[model samples]
Target chain A: MSDANDGAATVHLTLDEVRALAKAGLAKTGLSPDHVDAVAETMVAGERDGCASHGIYRLLVAASSVKTGVVVPDAEPVLDEPSPALVRVDGKGGFAQLPFRLGAPLLVEKAQKYGIAALALNNVVHFAALWPEVEKLASEGVVTLAVTPSHAWVAPAGGTEPVFGTNPIAFGWPRPSGEPFVFDFATSAVARGEIELHRRAGKPVPDDWGYDPQGNPTTVAEDVLKGAMRTFGGHKGSALAAMVELLGGPLIGDMTSLQSIEADGGRGGSPIGGEFIIAVDPAGFVGAMLGEHMKHAEEMFDTITGQGARLPSQRRYEARRKSLTDGVDIPAALMRDIEKLLEEA
Target chain B: MSDANDGAATVHLTLDEVRALAKAGLAKTGLSPDHVDAVAETMVAGERDGCASHGIYRLLVAASSVKTGVVVPDAEPVLDEPSPALVRVDGKGGFAQLPFRLGAPLLVEKAQKYGIAALALNNVVHFAALWPEVEKLASEGVVTLAVTPSHAWVAPAGGTEPVFGTNPIAFGWPRPSGEPFVFDFATSAVARGEIELHRRAGKPVPDDWGYDPQGNPTTVAEDVLKGAMRTFGGHKGSALAAMVELLGGPLIGDMTSLQSIEADGGRGGSPIGGEFIIAVDPAGFVGAMLGEHMKHAEEMFDTITGQGARLPSQRRYEARRKSLTDGVDIPAALMRDIEKLLEEA
Candidate 1:
């Protein structure tokens, strides 16, 4: 049941089984059935694509947040028609998944109808990667960009204290066939979990990953967890992070990461905030030349791969292909944690 | 006139004088009078913002490109309304400056009318920073994002050869008062000009800035200029650069960086490619609450600066404020080269 070397164990589960497990755990949190269904799909996608950290592992975070009363378990999300080309979804302080799901169709429709569209989801507890949202839009034949600000756990490039989130930006581009090109990444040099893992393993973190309580760069993971993290690429990443805050926060008429964390009230729950999504139809720009333009995109891909450079999401897509045939493996302890939630419910 | 140590000579001129010089040199390129006026504004803006490279120094490059017939000095830009929300401008192989100028008003108008709009500039010779375009849109009280791919001079992360451009991403947000917030930066670790400057000074480049011909990381700026530069933030920046290429190139139905470079036929002129720009009107998202949302934005900025973290465009804005009255300094040697062009005309 365990791998002694890493003190870990895994359990294999088919894609359907993973979804069922996620749904059960989400249901245990008293989320509405329809909302649970929407959120579970993203969890399954994460697992299928080898993003174990964002996969069913998030079920624990969700359940815990609901129990802490930081996230609304069953509040219905409300869609707002802000403009012809702007869609706003008030999550009603619930999880962002359902609101995003409800808004996406309209976003895609608006993009096709108006050439471009923007979606803003506010008053939501965010606990998922942005890729799922962008990917969904891309599948509907559009280019998508999504961004969100997490809890302010990272510092600006020149600042000693935390002033920005481990903000993430996700982008997706539709392909002529097969899986879309997608990338979702945090601006933080490293994720908080990575530092926690290092701490658990009694190892030092890499420089630039984080700083000590004194605000000086340190490799001590524990200190960083208690202090602050740094953004990737220093100031450049900081700039991007600030941009995320502006777009997903104030622009969306929602809370900044600092405000989001304060709303959490030291509960260490999922950050309560907003998300910004933009969708653009290729047809709007290229019209009948869509196919021709897509071919040009493929040429770009070929050159990147031909030079032995892998495009973003290529490995994830590859993992997905294999996992679709061969079921995914979930860490046994994590599976046990999910089962615990179901049992409690 | 020469600085003893760096061998750089300075020439101080009023902003009016700078514009006159720029217009004179641009006229010598056989550019249309109106196009010259449009392009000259951007050049003057660069100088006033203390960006010497993008300032009047670019005049020499423009004149040389026109001389080689690689750039269409007098080509008229054609605008097409592909859709109610999209504006396409065929620069007809001329400077992007003129195309952008002709397209800006339409872009702003559409953003206001439709809430969101796109402006695509194709078949253009680009020789300027993207800030001016975004800033202008911001001046019109809208949020803007602009991206473009330069010639392929950068390598993808973990790749050995060049497969990407020093692609830049620029963003602008309108402020309640004062100038709008703006940032434009290349995804490359550093600009190609920085490496060339280092090479000229017989200095070694920093690690991760570039690689040798074999693709191994190197500190020799010369090797990097001949081989390939690396993207900033390693893989994250690489992903961003690829996104820029997709959104600005194929998405706009124009040439990719590699294609653009090849189209140049080794003339080493400005890259003939396309630019993609998006503008969003705040009123669409926040309605009459636009002022309230912007106040939230100011709060975010306050925290960043309150913690002593400088915002991305603060320095440039500060430079502009001072230079507006104090004027800007130009290198004496560069001025000589530009004046020589006027003499030849």
Candidate 2:
């Protein structure tokens, strides 16, 4: 893989090198080798899929959080698997991906036996993306819905000042074609990471994408960080974000207002990031009849998109296909930045 | 209670009277008395909350559907309860509200026992607003999520022709203030119901809310119906709606594309609808520690919105409160339309 730096410099680093570098950085923060490996894998997957904002870009931030003891590495999830159909975990301030990865197989296994299973994780951190997890489950023929709660960063309609994070929700369903329809997105006008990207690139953002400190639409990335982000669809996006906060922040015992208050008061960090996962078995509903319905649904989808309906995540996959088939193109400057992080370590 | 005629200009009718009229209309279409009453109750609730488009206004269309034999009232929901934690219901062509109402209770019951439950309802119709069901659960101290596949009337980012519906998703959680935080909204720039409202009122819509047949943004509601509805926040809203469609539509066995195709072939009526409901018990996490967290969550909510975070659905509740305290205020012209419907019946 070609490397790039934020300052427009180019360097060369294979994908493995980058992953190893990220893993090494986490180890420096007191994370165990296994846990560090898992985190690195999750972040690398994002980068591979062209989601730079969610991938290596977060390495420094996550490390800083760990260094500040904002997150715990050795924290074992508080498991509450009382039944075959139910599983719950308190992440206990560990890597967000750890609890999910640990719970995915268990939940999927339960679904196979009981037809459905749910695992709720409380007190994790920013899960990179839902598509990856959903994709994993979908590959195994399980339908999944993953929801994560967030903080106050996006404003509601007709008002300004952030009150919720761009809580993202994702879903995956399998088709007879052995392909999965995966959909994932943040419930905000735009994700904060996107803005951070623009800031790093020193580029102007779309006017309606964010707001200034006075709550006016702005093109400057810096202003949005100081103020609030706009919701995707005025009231609609705002409503969804609130839902995430309730689920990820409050309902699941993740970040509470008290936690934020404590964080703000310079007390030890405590934004218990929470996640909810649902897995389903087709046998519960249509059973063998599912194939028939899926075929019909496909025909219907084909008819509607006669010209072409862009299936969710198809674009990203296509991009990935192109990248792999041709070459994993990287911004020269970004590669340099990766090298810098490694050398600094 | 007062009765009115369609041609009798502005008039007032008690909520019960309106519901009765709707029930009578449904009865004329051969729906079972129980089913008609259930559907009528949903419409009345929408009207009481000032959601006029989803209220009595929809009765005409629904009755037409039943009269045309598009909706089968006697169809029973195919319940597939694989475990206490999950349920999958096939509406089998019944009224949309039937499965929604039934599913909510079942999911809530399961959640009450196991701390979490999920229900997926397939082959239904427009479920109206999701708040009532969520509020019902929330009032009982449970958190709920309700999502439904939508009609294909909205376009994804940078695309034209309605390939998606103004899919609405709702989330509800209880607050100690005797108020539940209930959020219901469409994933489009504006709700299809809102566009219908503007068209019925002979008013123009806002630019960017929808597009004309030529794929150009227009303020004309008629144009939106002919063209497409815009997704909120560009690609982000489109992505979210796509997720809803996959989970609530195809995965659940309702496909909008097929609905349009069947409609064209005169083999079906309005699109079949699908919905997913999830309920989670807070005690599943912190156990007895949940009470303290709830308090903290509410406080944090208050602190954020106390400064400026507008809680979702707050305005709707405020409007409903005002209407109840001051008496349901019916606009002069709308009152006439209701009277006309009664007379026509």
Candidate 3:
């Protein structure tokens, strides 16, 4: 397909079809069949949930990481219990998804036994969105919190230098029925991907989104891409980002964002850092009040939504519902790229 | 003292002098001697750290809450272990400080034993800042996180109704040699105290700080105080505030922000809600590497601050150091009010 024409066209595919295409593209990157399935399934979820930034758009980037030997396609995560309630997983310089998957059962088991459990995954490349992992635990009736660091793309509140990542944190709360209340957000004023999109479209971003190369606040998307992103809520967001770096990095015996960048000689692609996940069983503290507690949460949600305020995951849920019937709309150009990768395999 | 002239004067008091004065004022509120000392010490710390809003300035509010029977001065906190790794405390409708104090030793013990521990405090009126509680745990080489719900003062993003609390969350990370790193901030764009200060000064706040009664964004401090404060970071902060409401409220079988306000019959004072605390031992995960991990964190701090970035709590630490030598500076007007409270007691 001609690039110009392909860019203007969109391809609709069912969830299964997208998963199959993603799996094939991932397998072509020399990942083991099992590993490919795991990663591809997560990518499919990203597409299904309208997280286009984390979906098939990232397939080529994942392949490049594998080609560059940054990620070991066949490495198995090593799990150990540092304490009865702490599960440590060494990702063996591989994808974070597999280790998280390998550690989930133990995390759930320990949480049920001890009322809470923590899983610390180190030496992994965390390239996917965090909600999927926490959502998995929440689906099993466990409340979960997950945090991971990334390359430093954000400046401290008053500093010009990029010293922190657009550090993302995810929280999941189980409900009595239906989907859990889940929210995942980066601490930056705007996600880097959104800025990139704006730059591509020659658009100006909001004034608070980022700074220019000279460290002056700017609305120019191109300038923001060349400079640094601001933290979401100024100093407050910066502090939270710093907290995430500590909890997900050094606290887990992994590299802080600056350390990771320094070790990579300033070369950046996917984040090679640590993932910290904590799971808590509601019954442990509230006892029989768990049901009532969840009901209260549901009522608050209704009250807020009734006031015309949208919840964090509300848009994603709406997109998901639409996608379920209409299928995912993939750019034709990206589809062609994926097909090309499959043919090479 | 005349109101105008006293407001212009600054009274400097030594740490001991401040503690004595605060104790005298708290004792006048009909609290037990032990409770008076406990509450007074926290107030002294706030003054010592230069938190003007939370320090002796709030003494009258605290006293009024006691006098009105909103807080039971002699109520003893009851602590029980819900699980091996969970401690639950019922504050008996008293001060949050006592429950936190009563639960601290057990929380530390359980964290040391199981790698992590969670303390849920309910029915407590949280009158002070959260840092003191977490800082106490961090001093013992435990990383801690604490969150509490308050009366509704912040609005959900995209809505003007006051539905969430300022909902401050505090985090403390233990350092190997020096004092621990700690940060406490409300999820709102600006703290309510700050807005009140702006209103008193007849100054306009930032446009993003709050909304008018008509549900439109406003820079008028008076309008914001009469309406609702906006969450920091837009939707991201709202989500976090909601998370706090869940974890600190229903998850602990305590009143949510709205419920607390309603139960108060719309009479606002200090927050009567729940407090959730989690403590984790680094030795349980990285063992001897804890020192190295802390060193790495220090290096990041150095790099950031060396480039002009100020870490959260940096100013507080500076203030505390200055206070040690020069004493705390209190507004003369506030001192007069505190003296009146003491005399009335």
Best by TM-score: 1
After superposition, the stretches of candidate 3 with alpha carbons farther than 4 Å from their true spots are A1-6, A201-208, A212-223, B1-6, B201-207, B219-222
lDDT: worst 10-residue window of model 2 chain B: B1-10
* Winner on TM-score (2 vs 3): 3
lDDT of each: 0.86, 0.69, 0.84
**Which sequence of candidate numbers ranks them by DockQ, best first?**
3, 1, 2
Tell me the native contact fraction for each prediction.
0.72, 0.36, 0.79
State model 3's lDDT: 0.84
lDDT of 1 by residue, A179-286 (tens): 899999999998777887889889999877877888888989999987889999878898898889889988778888888877777888888889999999988888
Query: What does the lDDT read for residue A24 in candidate 2?
Result: 75
Provide the lowest-lDDT 10-residue window in model 1 chain B. Answer: B1-10
Instruction: Indicate whether candidate 1 or candidate 3 has the larger DockQ.
Output: 3
Query: Tens digit of lDDT per residue, candidate 2, span B1-345?
Result: 111112335446577666776787667667777678778888777767777666676676776677777788777777767555677777888877777666767787777676667788777755467777777778877887777765677786757777776777788888877678888777788766667767877899998787899978888889998788888777777776766666565555556533543453543356666777777776665567788778767865675577665677676687667655554544566555445655664
Q: Calculate DockQ per candidate and list them.
A: 0.76, 0.41, 0.78
User: Chain A alone, model 1, TM-score?
Assistant: 0.96
What is the Cα-based lDDT of residue B253 in candidate 3? 83
Counting clashing residue pairs in each candidate, in order, gives 0, 19, 0
